[model samples]
Target: MGTFITCAVTGGADTVSRHPRIPVTPKEIADAAISAAKAGAAIVHLHARDPKTGQQSRDPELFTEIVSLIRDSDTDVIINVSCGMAGDLILTDTPETQPAGAGTDLLGPRGRLQHLDRLCRDPRLKPEICTLDCGSMNFGDGDLVYLAPATYLRPMAQHIRSLGIKPELEVFELGHLAFVQKMSAEGLLDGAPLIQFCLGIPGGAPAEPFILDAFKQLAPTGSVWSAFAIGRDELRFVSLAAGQGGNVRVGLEDNLYLEKGVFADNDTLVERAVGLIRGMGGSVMNAADTRQKLGLDRAH
Candidate 1:
């Protein structure tokens, strides 16, 4: 009945230049995940980056190397690979080029699953869970769009289920949760849906108490849900979520500072989350207990 923490070690955001240390390489990312696990994170969410340029990458090879390192290190943590990459749709003003311009990496549902397909084929590389972004949204206040329509999500969910990987339904806004309910009603999702309320992103839900309360009420009943906000509100949501009978997530991916002007790594962010949950009189769940609770397959 205690809350569990999911540390999103590194996200696909362009945050390398902003933070002194953001885990750009496979080794660094794997090391961050392992360290966070040691610091009491039950799950480590991951996103790969281009080693040479430090740009976000959906390359299966990078993921292969990253997961191999984690599994080889004998770390006991749930691996949740992000399937939310390659969905950027940057709008172009040029009439000739039309919709997509530079930085557009849109792909079909199956195309987006290329990395998962490669990883799941190898028993040793298959992660315990993978994310399924439930809807499309403006990436920010810019021309970029994170496109993942219902058509794309249905097949993606079905495919993730087929791979025997638990799907973490990431809802960025209230409307997205409605789609989750629909997907659940249609049986696209397996087991009690694992939901993550992603707040504080521009053009998405704001990281506020009233909004979080609304999300909690609107989320599907019986869902194993966690909530997080970006930047300053990241750790604050940890306290909010646990106080409301929900799990929490925190890491450098969401926030880069332990406090004002202080850089934070994955482990410290997780350690802070542990303190918050424990101080609230809530126990923390380990990787094994998390798997059982989420109905995930045994770790390979």
Candidate 2:
């Protein structure tokens, strides 16, 4: 089977602290995405951030600027915006002491989709796909928990369905995949659902061969599935997922180094993925075919 590779640019959080060139501004983000598309990525996934402070943001204006720049560049790539921001639940020192600490960014379904809604107003700026974190789980070993309980997901899923845009279900655990499959059965999701297996996270499934095999068994039938792992497992999963009849994702969002201590940019990562896919005897897909396969709306 052919592969659909997506380059996840700068992540959903502050990455400037992690690496020198993490793409904080709109122009930088757009430029990185353009380069990724040229390097053979079918889609470019984006997460907004404050231009000045290099902090993560869900600002519609920021998204507008990024989308506009990408569109104006005449780049032929699918734009996959992120809607993963949640009302953070942070319990400082003790649960009773600081129930909602300084790091907490608690928000409801509507609040999380605010930026997505604003983007839809302009057909040219609308994204073809946006992420939907499948379930609530403790974010890493920290005091924060990324909450996406039934209450939030029910309405949020409905909103995404109404928009008629695809929601790439971000599955951190097997249970998350099971829940989204149920939602699809109930007709809350549109088209052939796209499920992204996100492994190697702190509180979720580790990047192991057996776990990936199990996730494939649990994934919904007739769904477009892609998988990615953080850090070193990132490149390895490319061949593994393709061998298992799934697509793959790669970029700076998951790893900074192209090699041992060698920091790489978004374009470099995309080029590597292209080489890997071709090396595996699988052809890399372009944006137009990817849109047709995933049932995504086109940019005007």
Candidate 3:
């Protein structure tokens, strides 16, 4: 019930391409995790990057290295893997194209979850929490759409729950929240459901205070929730989320610049978020408190 902060260490496939300071290798991510923990982030939502090219990857080895590095550091931040990988989007050549392009890697629900299963199998790399994008929508600058129908989500939900890892339901819009509630009603999402209200993506929910408030109203009663805004509104939504009794998330995955033309690393983002949370008279939760608040069992 108290405020908790999560730092999304490195995100977006284009992050390294966009910012030189963004963490890329295992050591960099581990260092960033420690810095974030020191700056009051209780959780580090992880996404691995290709060491050479800095592109996003689901390689189990990469995940293992990152997790192990963090574990060895004694930082104690909760590790949350992204099950929302790159395999869901359908990017067609034109609006009328029946088939998607080579750039797209659309797959069935099970295929999308392959990396998640791999991570869950390793005791050392097992994520205490993982993401479950509740609904799908368009993701590109034009006509690319990501498919996440209930047909896909239901089976994925069962798999995540079976792994003994909590699913952080990522709701991009109010309708997505309604769908997540329906899943809870159907008993797919067991225990105290954790939800993340994602706002201000290109084709999803807009980042406005009223829009966030409406999504907050739609949250299942007694459920734990967090909220984040992408790009320019990241800090604004952190304040909004904390004031509204929800947790906050901030990092390079959602935004690149700390200020105009000024690139930010994970540590700077976490430091800024800590300042904002404390500035509003809200205290940031530690890893143990965060796990307790979200009903997550500590990983051995």
Candidate 4:
């Protein structure tokens, strides 16, 4: 298979104020996805932000607008909506108090998947895949922990399977892959399993060649996987991942810089990845081919 490029156009949460062109509205997000498809991206991962405030949103209507606009356009990229929302945690400073302060957005399985439920029911907007973060960890500094407890994940995995949408397993740490392997062995994941090695997310594995190698080595054999890193390591990981027989994911969602201190849009990042893949004597896969490769057309 050729190197597949998945462009994550916008993230549910981001440092959007730092960059001027982060897409906030449905029209802006759809336009970015269309441009990425034109630039050789096989898949477009989507996240919705409030139109007025630009904060992350779990509103089904926002997703509907973005998916509708993209489908209405000329592009034919596979839509991968983020099902990993409302996991943010911001804790108070007091050592003994242990109170989750202003930024906490944790939700139970059903609450977290409210938008995904709507997507699965909407024939026109149902995504080809949705993210399922395999484990939980300390997000950044003291008291900020991200949770995807097994108690929550097992049921959520079954729900995703029932929806007939592929769950792109997002493994941050090596232990996280254990759950994924378990799910696959138990027949929860249909077709070939799809995995995404999310590197350099504060608490996860660092963005380095050896760490990525370890992830690829430990994943379920024959799983179709893509790997990416955040910020400065983003492009470097692309080159490293290509050599390891993994697909590539790049876009403003992962990194804002096109060059040193220069902001970029989704298309530019994907175009650069296409060039990088071709430079390595590999070609970029188109949307239809990627879907076939990932067995996206298979019934659940």
The C-alpha RMSD of each candidate to the native structure, in angstroms, is: 1.0, 1.1, 1.6, 1.7
Q: Supply candidate 3's per-residue lDDT for 50.
A: 87
Clashing pairs in 3: none
- List the candidate 2 regions with Cα displacement exceeding 4 Å: none
* lDDT (Cα) of model 4: 0.88
What tens digits encode model 1's per-residue C-alpha lDDT throughout 60-104? 999999999999999999999999987888898884759788888
Q: Against the hidden true structure, what lDDT does model 1 obtain?
A: 0.93
Q: Residue 27 of model 1: what lDDT?
A: 99
Model 1: per-residue Cα lDDT at residue 205: 94
Return the TM-score for candidate 3, rounded to 2 decimals.
0.95
For each candidate, the alpha-carbon lDDT, in order, equals 0.93, 0.89, 0.84, 0.88
Assess candidate 1 and give its TM-score to the true structure.
0.98
Model 4 ranges off by over 4 Å: 298-300
In candidate 3, what are the lDDT values of residues 1-300, reduced to their tens digit?
A: 469998998874586767888888878887887888888889998888888888887777788888888887877789988878755555566647566765575678778777777776767678898888888787757756767888989999998889888999999888899998899999998788899988998888999999988987888887888999988899888899999888999988898989888988777888888888889998889999998877888766
Q: Which sequence of candidate numbers ranks them by lDDT, best first?
A: 1, 2, 4, 3
Per-model TM values vs. the true structure? 0.98, 0.97, 0.95, 0.96
Q: Supply candidate 3's per-residue lDDT for 46.
A: 87
Going through the candidates in the order shown, the clash numbers are: 0, 4, 0, 0
